[model samples]
Target: MKAADDSYVRVAVLVMLSLSLLAGICATLIHWLGPVHRPMDLIVPPVGSAIFGGLIVALWRRPWWLQGIVRLALVTAVLALVAPAWFYTLQAVSTPGVQLIVVLPPVSSLFVVLLVMVMIFIPGRLAFVLALLCWLLIALPVLAYLLLHPREAWTPRGIDLLMAYGPVSLIVVVLLPVQRGMAGTIRRLASERARMEVMLHRDPLTGIHNRRLGERVLRGVFDGARSAGVIMLDVDRFKAINDTHGHPIGDRVLQAVAERCKALLRADECISRWGGEEFLVIVPDIDAAGLHLVAERLQMAIARLPVAPVRQVTASFGATMIDGADSFDSVLQRVDRALYAAKEQGGNRVVLMPVRPAAAGALASG
Candidate 1:
């Protein structure tokens, strides 16, 4: 999650830097083409563009000082607007009969951009704190000047700038914490939902899929008319092991068996704890030969598994392939019968059951 957040921040920073560079180029172009050109426009835009370009390159390289660099860039952007507003305001004060509305820079709209950047890039209380500081630095002077010139403050442009810098900025800062709280709530709920889903589908003892999930997967296979191999496995003499070494040792044995079996299966395959000392495996897209081979491998793996304080551990496997016309119950019944046959045959062996003739007819008809 931290890596994802860092990635988001990097992308946002790059976008912001690119926009700043573009803004500088546009400002320079406007000054160059306009009938009246100012020395400050030529000097500031080119210099600021150079700074923005350098920051863009630095962000692309991604050094250890990237966080400090972002902070610096944000500060520079804010100052670019704030300095102009202050300068024009000071100039207006000195000149008599100067129409403040026409002469004053429209820096209030740009301040909104800086405020949004602060809110997005900065975290926790610091963001609001920075916002307050920004309001003070940018709005305070204009507000004081307006208060002094009451007639100008009541004008359309004056009122617009006043509301923008004052109430509008305040509302944005005040509502942000509430927005952050709601976002945090959403994240927590999503995380909790994922955890509950895991608990629902997973067996508590073996940390494998539960019977419910296994049945669901089997049902999906049947619904899709796909071929799959089902292996019903039972730990041989599980009750005897529990009686001799206690339930704790038996649990450990089950866990080890589950781990080993899971390791052997493909990512598309699933193994579930079907019941006590029993597991159900679903391997998709397998033929009868491949299914039998898989069952043999699982049997050998269990036979070779060494659980401490036990001489040896083994499991019996009953393997069968899906018939196209088989229902969930019918397939499970076939696997269960095969498992019973394996138990009867001295256990710890793979038993394969062929598809029923009626089911094969159903398949052929379909």
Candidate 2:
């Protein structure tokens, strides 16, 4: 998340620098072509344009110096804006009548832009403090001058500038924190919802999908009319193991078996803790041979692993392929019966059940 935020900041910096460079160029062009031209416009615009262009090149060459460059750019922008506003206001105060052609309108709007940048680039309370200082530095002088000269304050231009630097700027500064708070809330809620969803579908002990999720997946496969392999795995003599080594050891054994089985399966396959001492494995797009192979692999995996206190831990697996005619209950029953057959034949074996004729017909028809 921090890296993502840094990336966003870097992109923002590049865009702002490009825009500043463009604005400078346009301002210089306007001064050169317009009827009313000040010497300061030619000097300041060209110098500012050159500085922004240099900053852009520096940023492109040394991207890692983003933080320092951003700070410098912001400081320069604030000075560029505030200095003009102050000069124009001071000039107006000294003159006999209202200087209707002052730079207050654009400068006031740019202060708002600066405040927005401050909010985005700076973190925590510091951003708010910086915005307040920026507002005071620029707005105070203009506001004081307007109040003292009521005639100028009453004019349309005066009112527009007054609103821009007064209520408009203050509103932006005040509401930004509220907007940030709302965004933070949305992110936190989304994170929490994802966590809750994981908790709902995952078994706490083995950290595998719970029966609920397994059932949902099975239902989806059946509804989609897709062929799949279902394997029911039962830990051999789980009760005896619990009785001999206590439940904790039994739990560890279960966890180890789950891990081993999961490692053996493909990404498309799912293994879930169906209930106590039993797990359900779902392998999509598999035939009887493939299904039997998967079951054997799981059986071998469980038989080979030794869970500490016990020299060996084993499980019996009953495997079957889905048939078109098979209902959820029918499939589960067949897999359960196959698992029982494996256990009866003496646990730690794989038993594969073939599709029944009626189910085969249903499958063919489907």
Candidate 3:
């Protein structure tokens, strides 16, 4: 797991680095053009944005430090980009003879505003604010110099380009990552919901469907679906095992019994721990006669299951088919009575529910 996680982190970082490099190229071109020229390098924004998007997906499951490292690397990339541009501007200042290329009047800072909006949505508040503060701290001296001296640095054309592109750079930084964060958060929430559903429906100890789920599945099967049967199983002498060998071993025995039952069941069947030492089995594709064969096989399967030193770790099974006269409750009551009959007749036997007619049908027919 760690190796896979590390690989994902490396891939995410690589993607982010590649995007940053592309952004650097676009920034260089933007600076290369000056005086009210438009940003023809529109392709760079999306490439950079996608790289950041990939990084967010990769880092979503990574350790906190890896996420921080990615962010820090982006900040460094920004500095590397802006620093060289300053040098380029300085050279332009000394050479009065050089003619400057011009683009749409600088709207860099305006771009940063849009980025901030994105950041607020994606990276969450803490990360977005921390990043903004870091950028502000780094730019404090430069911002102060620009404010205190407002005197233009370098060629008239160069300063105008900075005025236009600076905000765009900031906006791009904030917006790109923020959008990715929003997507990651949504994905995370969906995953959590799926996991919660699984937990609610399954038994943690036995790794089988729980009682609540078993009933729901059985109802669906009987309501409009296939012919079905209910198999109520009780581990014969299970209470004796708990009394003599202690609860811990008894718990293990229960777990063992559950696994054995699961092994015997078809994929479409469902099993649940009905209560202490008892279980409920729902077979989806069987009728009353078909279920009798299942009960015999299940009884044999229980005999085969091991319970440590105990020589006879067997279970009693009582099954019933849902006929026209029975509701779900009536079926359950009949099955319970059948199970009691098996125990009373001597343990480890399969007992089937007795058929009976409904009074309403008799009275109406009469």
Candidate 4:
């Protein structure tokens, strides 16, 4: 189900459980305080309240069990509403005086509650239909009893029942379409926003974070860390591969390189396709030795296997550890110089750059 639909169902569950609990408490109180009354009046409310309260607790603690709990609620609600109406209709037939016919049965309130529950939990046209059917089933038997015995309709109880059942049911039914429309709109908007975000921050070809997202992540890493590692890598002889084969094969090689590097890095590390054939990596809370180990692992992982269609491929890596004093531009310049040195002498090697004052820093090959 869509998130909006699931949210509506949860809201419905909470509302039904809460109202059922309150109704149960009131019914139990009425039985205990009021006259002896009907046998069911005493029995049903306390049991119903206890069950509702238990279900609420289960839902709060284990939301994963929602499907089972909702099924139980539906069955319980049907019985709670239908059983009472059936019992009261039988009582009206045999009993005497205003007790059965006065003030429209309390069952009407229960009917409305059931209708609200179905409307919110079940979505679309089906929910509305179920609400209407439930109302008919619960109300039909009592309506028939009043019709068969004309004297019963003349009483105040019959008029109150008509008033509660007529206008209230109509209003609740009307609201279903409105709720469905609003939920659908919200789901559509959420989906679109997610699609736009992916397009904006993700690389079209490699399915890894693009340069834009990498920069944003780098800023976050820089803010939080005292020392961090920044590695710049370039595929050796990348242009020759493109010329020898084709751009499609070249693209596949890039994707393979990304997959290999991603597998070897920790979760907190940020890796992105810095540009065509060049990638940037940021590892926070890492020292010079840790950064060198990471760079060596990446160098071996890429050079060990010939990514299909290219008989052999190797990458040159330049890594440096940054402290509180370094600026982003300064770090990039240092790593770039290391990358240039690696490519100049040999391709399959790792170079470590020392970070010191601009004049003091020196490059060392690893």
lDDT over C-alpha atoms for residue 106 of model 1? 56
Per-residue lDDT, model 4, residue 296, is 91
> lDDT of candidate 2 vs native?
0.83
Q: Report lDDT per candidate.
A: 0.84, 0.83, 0.63, 0.80
lDDT of 1 at 37: 70
Ranking by lDDT: 1, 2, 4, 3
Tell me the TM-score of each prediction against the true structure.
0.73, 0.68, 0.52, 0.82
Worst 10 residues of 4 by lDDT: 96-105
Residues 63-109 of candidate 2 have per-residue lDDT tens digits of 89998888888887887777777777776777666473354435566
Q: In model 1, what is the error at residue 245, expressed in angstroms? A: 3.8
Better of 2 and 3 by TM-score: 2
lDDT of 4 by residue, 1-366 (tens): 467666766767877788888988987897789765667777778888888899999998987788788878876887777777778777767677534465233778777777777876676778877877787777777777777877766677776666556777778778766876786798789889998997899888888889999889877766774578899999999999999999988998999999999999989898998999999999888788889989999998998756777999899998887767777788888889888878877878888878863555545454
Model 1 steric clash pairs: none
Which portions of model 1 show Cα errors greater than 4 Å? 1-80, 105-107, 222-227, 285-288, 354-366
In model 4, the Cα lDDT at residue 117 comes to 71
Extract clashing residue pairs from model 2.
Answer: none
lDDT by residue (tens digit), candidate 1, 1-366: 567667877888889989989988888788788786756656677788899999988888865556987898888887787776777677779889875677654567768888878887788889988988888888888888898998889999999888988888888787777787898898789889989999999999999999999988988897775689899999999999999999999999999999999999999999999999999999999998899888888888888998988889988878788988777888889888888888888888888877873444211000
